[model samples]
Target: MALRVAAELRRGQVVNLGIGLPTLVANYTPPDAGVIFHSENGILGYGPHAAEGEEDLDLINARGEHVTLPPGGAVVSHTDAFAMVRSGRLDVAVLGALQVSEKGDLANWMTPEKGIGSPGGALDMAAGAKRLIVITEHTNGGAPKVLKECSYPLTAAGRVDLIVTDLAVMEVTGDGLLLKEVAPGWSVESVRGLTGAPLRVSDGLKEMDFTLPQHPPVNKVYPSAAEAVADVPDGAVMLMDGFGGLGGMPHYLMLALRDQGAKGLTVVSNTVGIARVSGFGTPPSPDLQAVDHSILVERGQIRKAIATFPVSPSPSRPSAFERAYRRGEVELEVVSQGTLAERLRAGGSGVAAFYTPTGVGTVVAEGKEVREFNGRQHLLEEAIRGDFAFVRAHKADTLGNLVYRGTSRNFNLVMAAAAAVTIAEVDEIVEPGVLDPEAIVTPGIHVRRVVQRPAVFSPFQPIKPIEDNGRG
Candidate 1:
């Protein structure tokens, strides 16, 4: 199967090898091949397997387990990693799968069999990449892994473009699956017979010309505080910013950290919402309890959360109920929105404390110093810091200047400027000196990495005219 699979590798491709099956590709990438491997945890260079005591403690791939960085390899935060993927900086993303439908839909995130099927980075990779290459076993339990159609749950709707199995290589097309190449000893029909699902054939099905994936370093365009804290040792305090999915790339990077199983993360954000898009213009009221990645952290899966605010979900959803049931483990400390913003700002400004009336008489005042000024009481909140900050903006110029769009500007701009390392994810990457200087929101000084994501999903929230209220 390795021999059959190695042929699909092409030199100079930025590749994402999936966790289980796809990770194997890292071991197989040819030494002479120049393909760069991107781990979601923010590493961009990889070398062959290491000899004893040769591996650097800092070099690691997206999965967060220790890995070796090839010569000229660099490390950034997960926010920077996804920036590369979303910006179309990568040539190919090799993902693993539970099933591949005739229509090329991938259902690898969760099987009915697995308890917690966090889609994690798969959703981002599937939707953001220009080309997605999935590598998986032909079948699970003698049932074909390829299917007439996916009966399991879908991770991203209709995203996969190519599939390489032990027996053959097939491409997804608008009409159906197209058989592109077959192993030397395997017949198309033989490959089809072993597949538990229906198969499609292309008019030009043939053997793939074997080659290694390519890797070429595009110059770094964005510079941020990441360079400032590059010397921070691994396993130090790391804080990220995002109100979960809608906010920006921070949550994406947080998931990458969770996957890496990196401990001692002192996450300080407004709120950790559900895995997918939970809140964004649902009327800023705080009744929503999003099922954040903290769900994993609370179960002793990761470390404890040291920030304020509990998961607030929207009305009438089962996930909200599940979150409530698990509230005991969450150990949340709720804070007012204004206070959260100020606290983060203070952290970035290197301020020890800030006075705010937002949480004065409420439960939020349980701990800390309280003082009366002009007959009004105020509680003091301390500053916070982390090894990194994952942020996404709408656009970036070649010099790493950034501009955010609409509600996308929320928490993102502040977090972008606040973190030790700010990674910007933009939908478009233009040449230097192109954007109007006035339109630039976050200056190039705050942004460390700028990657353009052409097809990053920004759903249209149709604006409706407000009907007249009785008060009006």
Candidate 2:
């Protein structure tokens, strides 16, 4: 729960940590995250828990737990710490809650059985912080902690923005508590069964993943794309993101994958690619090289492709995959674009099959199950998962969170989530927390490795303009 909330932290944000589980967020934050830890006890810029004998008497958090002070950290006066919270300098405040209401009311300070609890700065932080994240168990002693209304005294009304628990992660939205993601071993039905209030499920609801390192992840930065994808084996299911151009394709990674000679691969993508005439969605810039699926197809490394645009729009201009298919060297499974996107999303969300009304009574539905949905036939599309995914991003942090440029953010986002191991090729990689959390399209949890594109390399030659040697 703490790690999930920690992912919400952005660079240069001052976060106030309430007592208990909320305090553990400090331990999960990346060492170089650049987040300033604020405690009501007057410590600022504190580090993780202190090692046994290295504990400093003066360096303790609001909970009185021994902690470490990073360089440039300072001990402030009690007045100043509370002043920071009251003045709304804290970007986020994570508080422990006894109970939260559907209306976003908090009830952590006092309960009838618990009696009057220590009020302690929580009320002020809850009201003053830019955003509030509440961490707690989904239930307390067989009773739901998330209630239709808080029976206990309120800490702050309509202040909580998010709720993180062992069972589920929810957002306090206008409709109600919106179920975002559920923990592993939990089902929506089971979570709803335990909640005191009605829950509104999000369309993008997925499993709350914990694949990231438990304690501040080890630096996953690799030196180059070659080393990053060196271990990719034969007969792998590879996911490549692009729209027949350079906008979002993992050019360097695909080059490395080709050089690595990992053959007999099945590829999932939006297009099989027209390499010779492809650019960043422009009219094939001569200065830009298109190192997309065509490279892998030309190398004969791809055994098959699952794509929407498997062939070029013009029959005269055949893609490499199309030519290969003509020669019986490659296979194709055509799907509608929307179904393809949903199929990848289902793979990441652990759904085996979903019904869609696309391709009915057509060749696309030839071998699939057909069902009736509201008097319309829907085909059952099985989810597509990948052994490896090669994705491109404009920038990446050491932790592997990514920010894409322009239409480059297309299939890359869903492909990253659907793959077993995702390798990202980026132009720049910064230290953790260097990026705005909102700008990150692909979280580091889904990315296994980060490799920087070579600083100096020309993949395409500039085409010379044709001179008018004859009359038009």
Candidate 3:
């Protein structure tokens, strides 16, 4: 029989689909479904399942499954990804449920036993989507999945809108579960009997209207490169991913935020740039002056900066810099970049802490708790979380799935997986499903939103272009 549920999806709809059963809809969508698929990691514009022999090793879905890219697909960072979701940009999010309440609450992430890997960003998406459709097996190990109320840990208070199961498709109403369509070969009595929850039906109940008109999306575009920065919020922390200017600092945004009087930013990066390594008037340029973010950071604009190398290397870069360190001008926390990144990753993913051997010796072991494993000392690294992460990307789709083009992929992907919101800047946007499944490094699941950004030419004036400077 034809799939009744697939008809519920309309074209041009941005849909956030949970793992497993909900993913099947990607395959069943009509060629003209006009549906814009979203993966939580930050990919939008998803296409059909991947074809054999054409898999791009870099591409994969939220579940780490291979997928096809649709036409006009793009990749974005976690910041932009979550921004879309949190901003109420998605049309629908189809989720798989462990238990659903009559009130429409859902519990699909953690179970008493180990099942799925992690909830990832399902909770965020569930709470953010304009519409939520649940698709799941009718029962689990003989027990009905539907219940009068969810017994499992709740992800959101009350957000479910519809429940589609093998036995029937139901909508949540204030009165209770509104039975809409009974699956083929199933009678209303059979479905009612199967459900463990209190079920209700409208006297005027009828099969749901599944057919929807396909709407074409208006093409969206963005400037090549634009950066905007704001101060870390009160009671919030700031984090960055880089081993110094080896990866360029966030020059444009930092300046913007600085100008906005944004203060109390706690800067965290791999290391201080050349100023820390080279003395001023040194024969070779430390490559630090070219670093925009670091320059602003050194100007007392940043309240705190953390890195593996705390001491400025030359101890002699700028006369004032040496005096500042001696006088405690820039607060610093030294750590190995590896450990720091892992800590941030763990923190962002909700992991409490991880054990590593990178910083167990010498001064690195000062105040932190330490333990020995396999006859070697290890230090406990706590996780780090941030309100927003400014990450770079080559391309992103509307769904928020991100793909990095080159060295720029480094800390951006890790940061994408570790923030409340990630704003991704990319050079290009492609149709969904065009990226080879094997090529996707970051799945769309961790991503919340995406915006197409054009290419940026650097060293431009910060102020709006006044009278033409002939450089244009």
Candidate 4:
């Protein structure tokens, strides 16, 4: 079945193969065919499944299954990967379908009454791919899958172009289901009996061919957070994940970075640091409850900062970053939150620059080119890339596939894709196949190293006020 679909692919085409059987197309692709496989988890030009005993825990497809990489392959951030799909750069998208209507409506994300379904990248791919092809069995337990109208929720309307089932090949068109071919042993009459929708047999109908090919695995586990960040060098641009306060901050990695003693670093993140409680000033305490990038700032390791918030909300007690900026000890480039996200996404995705209206007509627009679109002014912002990105996650597999617990997922998802190397600090490390494929938020391919979060870091501890002795 996979070979039949692989035969349809052309040379030099960029394609996205969805989870499940659709991923098998990579293995069957002809060696001479210059096809590029893209995984929504943020990889392109990935090779077939790993050979036995060669699985790299840090390398896998979008489905969280281990895979190898082809020459010249690249990894990108989540937003950038979606940008590729939504920008119509993908030549074809082969996805598994639960049901495809005669009118070309697709329903593959979820079944009715099964709670809210995770759409993942299916919605964007359905609407963005230049061509969409579906692969699935002709029927589910003897029930027809090609239907008059999908009973399941639509992934995208009128988007399916072709479908390859166990028993037949069909093309979707405005006129309706056009039966193009049937399996070798199946006849038109047999196919019609299994189809819920009316069929239009093609004049050139023929038998579907069947042939198969072989393909091939890795695990990413580090003993400690310090060892995970040991390779990071001085004067590197580092991206830290966290929104406000310490909700999603990678404190362990930040601590490792501080202890690693890298100097002249440029930090990129949403905020400089959490506000200092009354007694938490001057010589910072390792037990300081609000530690974040501010710890780096206080240590004088940061030579510059690019962020949305670099000061404490209360002006009376400035953050370490604020004091550094006022002293001309560090450079600062403040950006809008949305713009910052897009910039990091763009940087990871091969996009040099883009225009957005978020920062127009303000200091954010200073020294940037402004263009008018739809009668509104927009500023051009270059993409922001990092030498390394430190992120936090709830759980991770030995292969580095990550699952976030809550708001901690925030920038961590995008930062994983935006860096040259991404080191994840996870609370727990499970074996491969333990985390559900659908639940894996950051795929292993985007991560270079995985470290277990330290036990000493307690989330519920209260920060004591800084001793007001003259240190203030």
Candidate 5:
């Protein structure tokens, strides 16, 4: 059944395989198929399941089983992973279903009147994927799982595109359930007998093909953050990976760059930094600890910045980068968030430039060539590249294969690919074989160095409270 479903996958499609039998599709995928597997736990480009002792406890799929990662695979934050689903970036989503209606409604997350269930990412994937394919048994205990109307709560209304059961292959069309094929030896009447919904056989019904295709994991680790940034010279363009402040910003690496005193640097990032504030409570002292690129700007390391948000909104509490720009000490080039991501992706993928309508009719279109496409104007935006990128991850093997945790993976994944030299600051370092091959988000080929963060740098540490400076 898994092989049959896998055979339906086309090359260069981004697919998300649900738990159970759907997960087996990864194993049957041909090495040259170019199907990128996405796991809701925040990994893309994952390979097949691991065998025996090859499992890495820290590396697992959404099903919590060990898996392998492909060469150009990436890991992202949970939010970003779902963003890819909700934004219709996923080509196909193969899921298991409890019940499916003739109108293509899906009901797999939960049962009717039973509040006990985990929806996980089913609703998002079902509604957002370009194609939703359900793979399940034809019957459960002699009861048909397909139905005229789903008895269970709907995962998404009228979203299923295809349904592959153990007994038949069906497509959900506007007309109704169109039976395209059946399992070998099973008569059309036999499949119709098992289906609860009205089944119309295709005129050219054929046997479902299940021919299996034969299928077919670096280092870079650095010692300290200081040593990792030691080679970054002055006036070099650097890609700083982070979203907000807590999302995998290379905090220690930024501190090291401040100490390294590399002057006149160009930095590209989502934000420059937040403002400093005094510590709260008993001590009532100024909180001088720097967590983002603000420290670099404070030390006059950044001569220019290309980013979406360069300063905090409040004028009275300007960020360090803002202060420097106001004083004619730094250059700023603002860009739309979407364009920034595309630019970096293009840079890493070796695409020169692309046009988009995002910044049309705005100041962002200044000096850039505009092209008309389908009666709309789009500005040509060049790709962004960097000499070095400072990234953070949860775990890395000796070969610089990295796995990120939770929301920390945001921009780190993309920046790793866009930089000439990618330096990763991770919490833990393991042996090369200790990591599950499928769990690695950043392949070592993209990473030039890996630095392990000190054990004391806890991700969950409370933000320093600002001291009241009498104004409050």
Candidate 6:
């Protein structure tokens, strides 16, 4: 049915599809068909639905799923969007129907069973478009919908040009409803048995084709980390993943973010900043401008930090974030290490919040809901999602599939899936099928952009175990 609807759309046509069933048409429209989809929400030529777990809260369709704009797509204001509708720019408007009459009357706004109805842009599209096509079921709960007169409230009278249903396809003419084609296994006599209006069977009537079509694959590679995070705005919640200092840190991306200068950021990380010890972790790169999230804090770009460890293990060597906090320069939300990882995982999985016993009885239980499971009290921890994720990986395919080495996999894998845009900096960029499928830590669907880290900097190496001397 979706293929049949897509066949009606011509190349270079601007189309508006109503909510619900009409939205499915966009999914099935062939990528090369050149049909531009315009949404009442103000985006024209938006790309397909976002890959799961990579939903950007800001860019969305009417259904509230995150989306993107094509290379030539335009994002207009709400007023300008309505202008496109009312100014006769739309060539076709395909909508779902509650009931359509023989005389081309459309009743799709509401039914008698429901009191409230949304007239959102449907009224405008119906009244303004050159052609209107209705897609719906033949019957509403086993009742006829192609009626002599519609029983539901009318959206537009004498406007519907075509109707496609589960039973048959009909064209509205000045005389009556003309049956152009019938669904498979459905005959003219059986269709007439279900219609309230008289049917005029076409001399060349045929069967509707239900062949499925394939959706196009998208390429998600960006040239540089700066360009990858170029669109990130101020006041964005960012997830930065690293453990044991620079081993798994997104060093170059953080440097790019600091240079990008988007202020008032709320960074969510396992640790607020990277801490270097005399003989542990990876040594800092001298040529690099900054090494960790502390660079952003030192530059005063971050407004708040939600972290598991905000201070260094060594009391004498305070990190930049601890200094900022001590001076009342930035806000902090302290979360337990386990709870923080779970929160990020939950956030990406669409869970709002969960209860945990890690922070219970401490200050973390202050204003949160405390639930008793059995006898122990648990504190509710809200999920931690972000606008952008800065991830470090050993390698990435052009499609953004990431593979990590050793400890680099910590937090990096989960953080990649927990943000709207996961910008990855990797040591190498390989083509598809070059990396082992089983070695893929995070699939390409969850990543938005991938940039190759320069070879000048070395990969993080782990500290070797110290041997004991028997001098004591």
Q: Which numbered prediction scores highest in lDDT against the true structure?
A: 2
- In angstroms, the error of model 3 at 21 is 6.0
* Ten contiguous residues with the weakest lDDT in model 2: 463-472
Ranked candidates (lDDT, high to low): 2, 4, 5, 6, 3, 1
For model 3, the superposed segments whose C-alpha errors exceed 4 Å read 1-24, 27-46, 49-68, 71-145, 148-162, 166-194, 199-236, 273-289, 298-300, 318-330, 348-350, 361-372, 392-408, 425-472
Best model per TM-score:
3
Candidate 1 wrongly placed segments (more than 4 Å): 1-6, 196-198, 207-472
Candidate lDDT values, in order:
0.61, 0.80, 0.64, 0.80, 0.79, 0.78
**For candidate 2, lDDT tens digit of each residue in 1-472?**
9888888787656799888889888877886776778888876667888999998887788899998865535555576566556544577999999999988899999888877678888998898788999999999998999999999999999999999998999999987999999998899999999999999999999999554343343556899888999889989999986765556788788877767777799999888876554434333464654566777787778899998988877788787789999999998998899999989877764567899998898899987999998999999999888988888888988767788898887898778767878898888988755776435666564677999988874444243232332311
Cα lDDT tens digits for candidate 5, 1-472:
8888998887656799987778888878875676778888887777777789899776678899898765556666676566557544577999999999899998998876777798988988898788999999999999999999998888999999999999999999998999998999999999999999999899989888786544331225666888889888889999995876556788778777877778789999988875232111112233335466766777677899999978776677777788888899999999998899888877665567999999899999999999999999999999898999898888887656688999888888878878878899888988755776556777554577888888787323234443332311
| Model 3 lDDT at residue 101 | 82
- Of 1 and 4, the candidate ranking higher by lDDT: 4
Over the full model, what C-alpha lDDT does candidate 2 score relative to the true structure?
0.80
Q: Which stretches of candidate 5 lie over 4 Å from their true place?
A: 1-219, 275-287, 458-472
Error of 3 at 23 (Å): 5.4
TM-score of each: 0.46, 0.55, 0.60, 0.56, 0.52, 0.58
**Clashes in each model (backbone N, CA, C under 3 Å)?**
34, 0, 69, 16, 14, 0
Q: Rank the candidates by TM-score, best first.
A: 3, 6, 4, 2, 5, 1
Candidate 3 has its poorest 10 consecutive residues by lDDT at: 463-472
**What lDDT does candidate 5 reach at residue 84?**
59
| Best of the two (1, 2) by TM-score | 2
Give stretches of model 2 more than 4 Å off: 1-217, 277-289, 457-472
Clashes of 5: 14
